[model samples]
Target: MKSLTNEVLHYTLFVMILETIEQYYTWALIAILLLNFSQRKIPNSQKKRFATIYLAALLLIFEVGVVTILTRGWPQKLAFLDLAICAALFYFFREKAWPFRFHCVNCNEKLDMNHIIGHDDNLCQKCYYEAHPEEAAKEEEKNKKLEPEQSSETLGLQDIPDTVSEIDWDIWEPREVCVITYLFENDQVLLIDKKRGLGTGLVNAPGGHIELDETAKEAAIREFKEETELDITDPIMAGRLDFQFKDSLSERAYVFFAHTYRGTPKETEEARPFWCPVSEIPYEKMWEDDQYWLPLALEGKKFEGRFIFDDQKMLDKSITVEEEDNE
Candidate 1:
């Protein structure tokens, strides 16, 4: 009888210890989650202090729980719950999951898992330091520099606002020289399916980066032949376009308007040629800026323009047009 009584008491004691441990774990999880939530809502000025306080509290709870487990003994049945609490703390306190795929805020660089610095701010390590130079005090911080990776994520053109002035264009450098050739036949225009290079899979005019010692016009004609297997002589210079991608890679493209050309449009290794009607050009399949200046160019007007892009989405643009006779 005494043996059975002792067994019952032992079982009750075990249950009590498990309940106590679970309570501690539950409280800790709730606190951690609350701290994470508050981090977003609190002002930047208070964040440092709040974070410090949160860390101190978390450590205190951790120490107390450890001591209690050591003194009162481990509850084997509650191991799962304890492990679950650890996971919750890990996920909650480290970083919030991104609602959308990652892209840098300044330069539109895609982020790998480890380099993501924050939530929607989404600045990659390089741009983050560029924007915040004061933080780059340690050599270890420079080791976090982000390198470019090939990505094919396209932005929906419909989401872009009509006129955007949000981008700061001063930091962008004009490092690349390229050309764009628009060939017209009656009311139809020739374009190509860009097979490779920067805007792969996108519909664009037949042109490419200028080779060394090549004039912009020479590059345009060369690129035209190379991509479309057609020859266009004396193609009129229509305008100049300066494109600055969100990552600050800049290109100066000399836009050419070609009304007369030789040979039939054919596919090449670089691009696949197709003719699109002027009245129904697929702006959706082309770069976002094409919709802006292409119409004016098609009307035989010369234009000079600058376009800023966040990935494939147009962020801001400005253009000046001139009469054909004036140019």
Candidate 2:
């Protein structure tokens, strides 16, 4: 009976190989089916050892299949030699496989044997490092002290996305921020020759985007210094304007009134400094909405306005201005 079973098994394997040799990958599928059958026939105590050998054998078969496809044609002698090598490797390493089970002590998570760094504590790599923060920090400091070695590893990876899809598009999206500043000396105001960036060539006050970690008030002060080299210690929040451009970009411009400042205004790459007589301010060269709201602000009124624009043309607009009756 045992001899009959052996003959039947050999005949089945031979027929499968003969049928699948011309088809290339079908032999791998047959091997997997045979492995499943073998696993069922084996006692439960021996399943793990069989599974490890099966996995290694499957990988070897897959690699040989890939090589055969790449070489375009497979010679019978080379194929037989490769099969013999795979069989020998499987036999040599079958008994030497690690026998220890690994699991995370903290989270009760099953872990791969390769991921087991310390068997005494049985902690996963991440949890082990976290539990020893002082050690982690010391290791980090040592890595930082490695100078050339550390620099070479991070030479190009810093601040660069590994793939185009990994880039966060929102960080590069268009943003509009309020840029308005009012300078006061008796009754005169400071206007800037809009030199480079947005609103270039147009007459506007000295203000710009609010930088990170700075309030709009601080931004107004910072922008004032960059554009005019003057510092405003106390800037009154005068009014606000909400503008929407045709391309869906929008901004809220916070108009500030600075009653005091230091340093003389000077020209820089971004703007040319100039004093405009309060009575003779250039309204035509300024933004259209500015003409409507400037008078209210000059009179110490608080206002809120909205403007819809197509390019430089104002498509729609509204304003509400009121004095606080400071009696």
Candidate 3:
């Protein structure tokens, strides 16, 4: 009789222990779900993906717990429900919840697992550097310090004559460095009838000489605003022009192209702004050299050209279309 009583007592104790463990498991699941939800609020893509994965795992655990409670045993055929749940989650959340990605979002380059799971952007190293150019610039500057210093060659040395053939372009420097920016919209490009500048009475893009402590791109934006009273953005370098004139005026011009600008083009003292069809650019009214390289620029090609001009006439010219890098 005493053994029978002891058996009952042990059975009751076992049931109580099981109940306590079940309660703890329930609380743990809730805590994990709460943590997953909180992590969803984070802006980091990797953390959000992790949270999604955690939520999926918690759902599976909950399924297993329900099956165990109902059957009083480990899942058997009910294990297939876990697989179904996985499929459903994948189907529904492939873009939003998947923790692993195989390629960069920007350039579509193959990404390793470290970038997949650890980085917020999931971009490959090259794409990452391209996106964060400041960091890349810093690294480039660091590397340049380790390399040999290059000689400083002045452009259009004062003694050099006004003949293009006589100039050694590799060592040539300009007496004045300038920039020109062309803004495009739809199928029309902005052109200016120069009112008071170097190309006065001629049609050209808004541009001017680079000022002290100014970068070529900065000069392009500033000159465009000053001449057209419009702010241009995302100016891309298209080509370089080296000019030698019979009057001994040697200049190097950087050409930029932009498709975005704010404010309406207003006539300024320097220019009368007007939009001309790309198919109808008044080449005859522009600089003679424009006919040669302007078409290339319109086609998004990079070029380098040298020209010798006698006043308004192009005396001699050489143009080479540069090969673009396959980024």
Name the top lDDT candidate: 3
Arrange candidates by lDDT, descending: 3, 1, 2
lDDT of 3 by residue, 1-327 (tens): 999999878666655654565557666767756656555554455565575565657555655654474457543334456547666766676666555578888778888755665567777888776454334334443443453131112223454455567666654445666888899999999999999967788999999987656667788899999989999988988888888776666677888899999999999989999999999999999999999999998888989899988677787888999777787
Better of 2 and 3 by lDDT: 3
Check candidate 2 and list the clashing pairs: none
TM-score of each: 0.47, 0.46, 0.52
lDDT of 3 at 294: 95
Clashing pairs in 1: 107-246, 107-247
- Give the alpha-carbon lDDT of every model: 0.66, 0.65, 0.73
* Residue 59 miss distance in model 3 (angstroms): 44
Off by over 4 Å in 2: 1-175, 322-327
Encode model 1's per-residue lDDT on 46-68: one tens digit a residue: 43334435554554555455455
Model 3 has an lDDT value of 0.73
**Clashing pairs counted in every model:** 2, 0, 3
